[model samples]
Target: MMNLISNAFLVVRPLEKRNKLIDEYNLIIEGLRSKGINIIELTSKEHLLSTKYLCSGHWISSLGKGVVVVYPMSSLGRQQERNDLVFDLLGRKGFKINDVVDFTEAENEGFFLEGTGSIVLDRLNCVAYVSVSKCSDEELFVEFCEELEFTPVIFRSSYSDGLEVLHTSRILTVTESFSIVASCMVKDKKERKMLSLQLKKSGRDLIYISEQQVENYVTDIKQVKNDKGDSFVVMSKSIFDSLYTDQKNTLGKHGEFLVFDCREIERQGKHSIGSILNDIFS
Candidate 1:
């Protein structure tokens, strides 16, 4: 679980102030840590920015039980950001990573699959939702599904203006009990219908959002439980505002909202609140 956001960001260079992003990221980290979310912040002097829509911190995933999946990024420069040193940092932080599944080899074949950005894993239901894009490839996606034994639900997230969504996390988010997705995230009606039906059949309540909210990153929230078993849905202030009253009401039915104003990072990083959170399961 390495955090690379508080330092490096490749978007909005004009209005971006490193100090502001640092302050906001620190605040978010403190808030989550208070709620018993174990986090490790990896520091690097290089101003490396990986993918345009993908969070640098989200370039890899802690797949629980000492296994991690390192992604094959489209940016060659970003690939250099993660190396032996990064893994060593995680090891020092008590992330017992005994095995690493490297997906970077696909870069030679011109196929790339970003971690978490390419696929949204419904861990409990054994399902995965992926948006087809340059950042996500079907071949690499199927390999990941087979490795995890998750049923893959393929869809193309296209906006009304004829733009395909780049990151799956931007369009949908799933938790243990529910999922929030933008109706316009998937352009294929049949695929969308299948996803909706599958989610419902799997016993998850759906909180559907609009394309506008998806652009605002409202659905990229993360649900976590405190040591006392209190549940919270963590999100940025902007995302919170983007939600409809009924949507907030629906979330309230499931968990408390941990909202903070992270406009600076959200704008420049193009990421939501949970974007920086890296979970290393015990």
Candidate 2:
């Protein structure tokens, strides 16, 4: 099966950045440019002086073609309609905003799902895989699933500190052929088995990674096609180094690997390749 078409991105330019941050950002920009992907960059008007996570991909989620979901961020600084500017930019680009969930009240009611960061969508199969975390509320997730007509597979996974993983995408990515996941993070036996079974049911090959690899941001990668319609997987050099030769060989059968040096960006807020690349398909 062909993977989701990812030819465009909606990125937000940070208002302030150090020299190293600029270098890292340029590397990602150049890397995508080399692959012939469109980059829609907008400068953030509001200054979040203390926050390092200013990536727009974490706040907006595309439900499907021509429609998108603007999430109520769980982050204190990212909240209070901070996502409107990015959504406004997207609106100008001809994307219709979805109102399936009451975003305005969701945050007041203590429910938050940080777009694609909190859940991984199997768009072809209409399934949303989510890990229950501080940023992902189970009740709201169910409501979203019902309204959006997506099957929600709820599971729980955490970091070594016993804190919930900030984003599910940091540990799991569901693609057409195979899924990369840090199963070790899922502490429970039955839930882990259920997640595996569900992926198998959806006809995806499971590629398991160690917790260390996940820490290295191995699962935080994006799959897209180049301008000539050739498939390519975009990831950081850290992710490439963390992978075993066998894993790389297996992934090579699916797409050409394009690696970038994003150590500086990742160091700031664990935001790397996938977190900044918001796919806007045409």
Candidate 3:
């Protein structure tokens, strides 16, 4: 119910290509911490072969309600990233990790669901908007929804280049009172109407973005708040810089803006600010 982020956990990779990502992660984490937010660190190790750098492992939102749910990694090397050690570490930190859902067997057969990145969660409304792609499985998504007591709103969202967008966060930005969505990627008019209706029913204003903006990953944003109860919107510098003055002003009306440089991390093409964010509940 709290739109303000008080605590978060970030996962980082130590690979050379991802070094900048760690720095960017640190930058955002530090910035949020400076505002009195608590941050937990989950550093990836070499032994976690299957889980190391895959987006699936870092999609922390799947483990909702402060319950850490580990998804079965499809990639062999990536599976190691979901080592029991990480879960134990979180438990030691006092995080309430419910059951770890093992979909490894299904993953081996090609079924997959990449956590919060693949599906955008409207926590307040108990709805999950999922964009089905190679990394997203319809059956698994339904099962996940059933488990979490969420209603699944599934659709396909593709980029202008004809490639399916990897994560829902790339094209959809949900806030407390408004949701910034990339309508261009949502091809089905009927489905789009349903999505719009759902947002309206949930008391959210829809701010539609063009395909051009989505292509540049300019629509991705997250809402946060400082300790004093002052709300802020956190986004990559690229997204912030690309926003039209009007769009920026509209967002400003909602809250203060906090932008972090993420070019190097984006270049690595694996993680984003949303991927590594795990909500910490006390």
Please provide, for model 2 over 23-63, each residue's C-alpha lDDT reduced to its tens digit, 9 standing for 90 to 100.
67877787778778778787765556434454665666665
Order of the predicted models by lDDT, top scorer first: 2, 1, 3
Best by lDDT: 2
Candidate 1: global Cα-lDDT?
0.71
Score each candidate by Cα lDDT: 0.71, 0.76, 0.65
Q: Mind giving the per-residue lDDT tens digits that candidate 3 earns over 1-282? A: 523243444445444445665676667777878876555565566644432263433334434455555564445665555545666666777766665565556676787776666677777787888887777787888888897777899888887678887667678866666688886787888877787788778877667788877755665566765557677777788777778888887788777787888676556653445444554443
Give the C-alpha miss distance for residue 154 in model 2, angstroms: 0.7
Model 3, position 105: C-alpha lDDT score: 68
Residue range 113-209, candidate 1, lDDT tens digits = 8777778877766778888898889889999889867789888888889988877888888776778888666777898897788777867779988
Clashing pairs in 3: 48-80, 49-77, 50-77, 50-78, 50-79, 50-80, 51-78, 51-79, 51-80, 51-81
Cα lDDT for residue 99, model 2? 45
Worst 10 residues of 1 by lDDT: 4-13
